[model samples]
Target: MKKRVKWTLLSLFIIVVIIRIILAFLTPGFTYESYFHLRQVDHITKTGFLNYNDDLSYGGRTLIFLPFFHYFMAFFSLFLPLTIVAKILPNILMASITLTTYHISHSITNDENSSLLSAFIVGFLPILFSTNSFTVETLFLPITFFIIYVFMNIKRNTNNSFGKSNSLWLTIKRKKYLYLYIISFLILSLTSTLTFLLIIGFGIYMLLSLMENKKINKEELEIIIFSLFFFLWVQFIFYKNSLLQEGFSFFWQNVPSGIITEYFPKVSIIEALVLVSTIPFLTGIFVAYRSLFKLKNKKSFLLISFVISTTLLAWLRLIRFKQSLAFFGIILGILFAPFYLEMEKYFQKTKLFKFKEFILPITIILLLLSTTIPAINASLKQDTPTEEEIGAFKWLNENTPTDSKILGTLEEGHLITYYSKRKNIMDDQFRLIDDVDKRLKDINSLFTTHFQTQVLSLSEDYNLKYLVLTPSAKKKYNITEFNYLSKQCFGLIYDKETKIYEVKCELK
Candidate 1:
């Protein structure tokens, strides 16, 4: 039975990986975020990897964004093409998450069937597949779960040895566990700010355990305290370097302040739930809550802690609905395993159908298919930049000087930086720069204003050398041509095939 379970789980993992690779091929460079990530990889490949500043965006300013994901990809780029690595990295990371999910769930439940079911759910859940893009969140899933697994195991080991003598030598042995826990915690906290919320969840778990047990688990408490201390110390470094100031200011300006409902639309919230395998997830939540009350064991504590932590973060708008939904899908799968197994057992004993054995597998298949098919299809069919747009970007790369600043709509800013390797006045990453509103207004005036002097003034102010008027921008601003700036003022160098235009004369 164990052998069968192992083979089945391995088969499922291989299937998931094959599907992800196919999807990666089908949708090459499908996401805008991928371009930004690819650019980072390219930068790392060129340079030695200690540099954090990206001179391509915001007119050659220092970047405060986390480089963990980029660094991870860079290591792979040594053996493979950067493009191939970027395309498949998300799938690779997610596949690891699937394996980790199985071990974590199996550790908690001690049921192989349930653990296999949980692994299947997480490996192919549509919401998770959809979010398997080139971003920090993609890598966060596996790292976060691995940390939980380590934490739970540490707690389990300490609990099993509760009566051991508190000798100096024994204390030294336990310090190794603390060291492991602290190292994992610091890795997560340093790599992504989203991990901070996971730490918050750990705190909640500790508090709830205290409420129930009337005393904190000393080992868990020590790990949590050390995690918080290191997390704050990392934040202090970011603060001292002025990186936190830039990020916080950007967040304040862009992220709306309000309740959760105000932040997410009804349709989006609905989509998030459905994408997460809604029925199974909700069922699992119910089961987890019931189990939490009935059994105060380490397994129950870890399960409920994850669910509650993700829920609180989602409720407080600390994470997006999609992200929260993805996290919930994993938890829901783990929690739903036992309930599903029970159902399977009951179905197996039924006399109404001769094929009662097929019931469990069929139900799981249907649930997996219902979500997986739509997500895969949607991912393959997702719209990316047109061929002409790609060609124009390529042209800009060849023609424009490396340091030339191009002024365009915010949409085109990052593409210019990523493809052309030139500086953009502003891009979609509005949160990273100061005075985004003013820069946005200036860009709008540069494109929309009919006055030639005003256009020249805005152009010279930002040291912009090229003007890219994409079809989308032209249609958006309702401009047929550059009516204000004539040939004498600004030479139209490359306007034959592409929507982009280059200014020939240098400004005084």
Candidate 2:
């Protein structure tokens, strides 16, 4: 049974990685935001440190971020190109979600087949198939789930030996799983601020357990307290200035109110069903309801709490849409194990038991069809730089001065810096900037305005020199060309699908 489980996990990991890599290699570059991460990794590989004082981004700003993810990527880039590390390592990390989810499912259901199937469902989850996204979340997701699995096993060990006289520290020292949980939790805590999601989930679980009159495990409560304080201290150490500046808004990462909606878009029931797939969505909901009301199931309470906490945060506009949905979808996939176990139990007592052999295969086929199609569609539709855009940026890098500030759409900010090796007026990193909304509006005006005076005015204030106009920019600003272009001020320099214009006339 252990061998079967190991082989099943290995097979699912291979399949997911292969599918993701094929889709990823379909393009020459990754999605726009990936360039930001690629640039960070490259800088770290060269200097053995993060570029907190990034010279190019936002035309030179002090960046605020946790360095673990960048350093992790940089460590691998020592042996390979950063681009190769970005493309391959992220997919491998993402694919390990299968193993983590399987262990989590098996811990809950104690049925290897159901756990393996759940792993398969999560491995191909559509929202998770952003194969080209070289972001922290790739490491964040699997490590977070692994931490949860380790935490759950700690609960199991505590329950099995509650009356033992050993102290908690002694128990942790004696049992390797306890040590593993602490180490994994430390990694999760440092990986991203998203670790707060788990801490919040733990709080909610305790509250729910109290409401239901369920007996809370003392060891689990102690661990939760440890995790909470430890996580808070780590975040404070990293984000002290951000916390002081943003206050409670730090929870939103200081994103401008005007664009917060873009990051944390509301997900409707229908949209969510499509995102998480039909089977896990419906079955997970069923299990959550049954566990909460009918059975008062203590074992399932933690998972339900995480699902609830994620939904609550997403609804409150706290978590990013994709991040929340990924968490929600994985929990539902694990919940499917309990649903499957229940269904199998029911089948054994019913006359329809003869058809049980066909159930897992049919479910797997349905899940694959539901998930794989959307995954491929999303990968194809992902907004990445074209060959022409890459060519234009490379030309800019070679021809332009190193200190040149290029203005493009917000999406092109990282692309400008990464490829052109120059400054961007503004990019998506909005953590500490006080004037993000104004910057965004100015960027829009720079692209959309017909008045040369207004263009030059904004450009002068931003210290902008060059402007890039691409299909994406034109489409974004709803313009055919810069209507204010003239021989006196804006000189067309590099022209292709992407156009770069040098600002010639200085406004005095």
Predicted structure with the largest TM-score when compared to the true one: 2
Looking at candidate 1, what is the lDDT of residue 295? 57
lDDT of 2 by residue, 1-508 (tens): 5887788789888999998888888867988888888998898888888889988888888898887889888999999987888889999898899988988888888899899888988988878888889988999998888888888887777667444476675476537777887888888887899999999999999999899887887878988999999999999998999888878888888887777888889877887887788888899999999998898888889999999899999999888988999999999999999999999889889997998898888877888798778877877777787878888888999999898899988889998999999998889898888788899889888988889999988888988999999988888777889989998898999878888899998767
Per-residue accuracy of model 1 over 261-349 as CA lDDT, tens digit each: 54443335566666776656677867786777775555667667878887777775666676777787788877767776667677667
TM-score for each prediction?
Answer: 0.83, 0.95
Output the lDDT of residue 501, model 1.
Answer: 57
- Superposed model 1: Cα runs more than 4 Å off: 130-132, 161-180, 243-267, 292-298, 345-356, 381-383, 428-432, 444-457, 469-498, 503-508
Clashing pairs in 1: none
How many steric clashes does model 2 contain?
0
Q: What's the lDDT for residue 498 in model 2?
A: 83
